[model samples]
Target: MSLKVAVIGCGSIATHRHLPEYAANENVEITAVCDIVGERAEEAAAKYQAKAYTDYKTLLKEESIDAVSVCLPNYLHAPVSIDALNTGAHVLCEKPMATSIEEADKMIEAAERNGKKLMIGHNQRFVASHQKAKELIESGAIGKVYSFRTAFGHGGPEGWSADGKESWFFKKDEAFIGAMGDLGVHKADLARYLLQDEFVEVGAFVETSAKENTDVDDNATLILKSAKGTIGTLAASWAYTAKEDNSTIIYGEKATLRLEDDPTYSLVAQYANGETVKYELGAIQSNDEGGQTTTHVINHFIEAIQNNTVPLIDGIEGKKSLAIILGALESVKTKRIYSLEK
Candidate 1:
C-alpha cells in the first residue's frame, strides 16, 4: 500500500527534498502540494503530478493524505503541524520546529494525543558523513565519548531565491530568526544524534553582522552541556565567503572521530592502541543540502509509519534540539546562559 503525502510548502525544500524523494519511492505518492503563493504550488504540483492548493487546510481536508511534510517558516511550524496531526496525518516538519519551547510542546502533545508519528526534518542526521559517524561510534572504535564540536556555515541563500530578490530568508516576520534557526539547529540535532544525549544547558553569543536590514542574528556560536556531561560547541553562520562547511569532531577515551572535515570521509579515527581507521561517506544527495535533509527525514517518517517504529528524529528529539537553539537565543537576549532544562 502506497502512502499518500500532502506537502504544505512548495519552497526549495519541497522541490529539492520531499517531492523528488517521494516521487522516487514506489511506496509513497505526493497527492497534494500547497503554498501561500499559487504559482509556487502549481510549479511543484506540475513537477510532482500533485494537486496544487493555496490553502493548506483545504489540502488536508481533501487529500486523504497518509502523511504531510510542513516546510513552512518557523512561526507556522507549530500550527501547521498540529493541524496535520489533528487530521490524523503523520507529519515531518522542517526544523527549528517552532520559535519557542511552548509551541514545540504543543506540537508534541498533538502528536501524542492523535497517536500519529511526528518527525523533525533534521536532515543532517541522514547525511552520509553523519550516518557513518554514528556507525563508527556504535562500533566501539571510539569508546566513552567525551567532548565534541560542530559547525555549519555558508554564504547567504541570497543567490538561491526564486526571483534573485529578497525573500523570507531575510524577513524576521516570516523567518522568526536567522542563522541560528536557519543553520544552528542542524548541528544541534546532529550533535544530539552523535552524542545520543539531550543537551541540558547552553551559553551563547549571537550577532547580526551580514545583513543590516535583518532583525535576527546572522552569526552565532553556542556552548552546550549534555545531560550525560559531554561538552560541545556549535557554530552557525550565513557570512562565510568561500564555501559550505558542516563538520563535527568527537573525542573518546579510545579513539577520535571526525565527520565532514580533515577528510571527505566520515572520520580519521586514531585509537590509543596506535591503530587508525578512515571511513568515507559518499555524497548523500545530488548536491542539494535542503533537499538531502528533506528526503532523508521523509524516508524515516514513512518507514516509521509503516513499521510502527520510532523515527530517528522524532518530535521529542526535535523539541530538545529546538530548546537548545532557543536557549542560545534567550541567553544572548538576557546576557546570561540559559537552561536547556527548561
Candidate 2:
C-alpha cells in the first residue's frame, strides 16, 4: 500500500528535497502541502496534485496522510512535528529538532504517546562517503580514532534560502541560532554517528561577526570532547564567499580519513604504512544542484514507517545531537565549557 504524505512548510528544503523526492517514491503519495505563503503552497500542491494549506494546524486536522515532513523554520519544527504525531501521522522533522531541550523532550513524549515514528532530517548520515567512513571505523580499519575536525560553511543562507537574507533564517527568534543550528547541527550528528559516541562536553566561540545587521550568529567554532575521550573541532560559518566546504578529517592510530576534502576523491585514507586509498563517491549535496543527490532520507523514512522499524536517527538520537549544539550555545554565552550531562 502506498503511504499518504503531507509536506509542511513549502520552502527551500521542501522545494529542493522533500517534495521532489516524495513525488519520485512509488510507495508514497503527496497528499498535501502547507506553507504560510499561500502562493508557494499552492504552487507545490498544484505540481503534486495535492491540497494546499496556509496553516499547518488546518492541514493536520483535515488531511489523512500516513506521514508528514516538518520542513518549517527551526522554531516550528518541534510544534508541527508534535502536532503531526498527535494526528496519527509519522513525523520526519527537519534538524535542530527543537529550539531548546524542553521542547525536544516534549516532541519525544508526543511521539511516544501517539505511537508514531519521529525521525530527524539530519541527512548527512545518509551520505555515501559518510556511511563508508562509519563502516570503516566500525570495522577497525582506522584503528582507534583519536582526533578529528569537521566543518560546514557556505556563503550564507542568502545564497540558498528561498527568501534570501530577509528570510526567517536571519531572524534570531525564528532560527534560534544561526550557522551552528543551520549547518553545525548536521556535523554534530555526523560526528556522533561516525564515532559512535556522544559529545559530553563543549567549549565554543560563537560570533555574529559577519552578515551585517543580523542578530543571529554567522560564524562559530566549537571544541567537542566525546564521552569516549575523542576530541574534535567543529567549525560552522556563513562566510565561505568563494566556495562551499563540507569536509571532515579523522585521525586514528593507524590511518587518517579525509571526507569531501579532496578535489578528485570524495573520501581518502592515508595510513602510517605510506599507503593511501582514494574513493570517488561523487559530490556532496549543495544548492547548486538539487533533486538528484539527496541522501536517501525520504526513502529511509518510508521504509521505517512501512516496516514498523525504528528509524536509524530517532528521537533520542536527534535529542543527543541537539544537546551538543545547545551546549555550544551555552558555552559561548557563559564563556565556559558546557556539559551535556544535565
- lDDT, each prediction: 0.83, 0.92
Score residue 271 of candidate 1 by CA lDDT.
Answer: 80
TM-score of each: 0.93, 0.98
lDDT of 1 by residue, 248-307 (tens): 889888987777776365567778898988777575442335444334666778889999
Show model 1 residue runs off by greater than 4 Å: 161-165, 284-295
Q: Which residue pairs show backbone clashes in model 1? A: none
lDDT of 2 by residue, 197-257 (tens): 9888999998898798799989999999988899999999999888888999999999999
Give me the candidate number with maximum lDDT.
Answer: 2
Candidate 2 ranges with C-alpha deviation above 4 Å: none
Provide the lDDT at 332 for model 1. Answer: 88
Candidate 2 achieves a global lDDT of 0.92
Model 1 local distance difference test score: 0.83
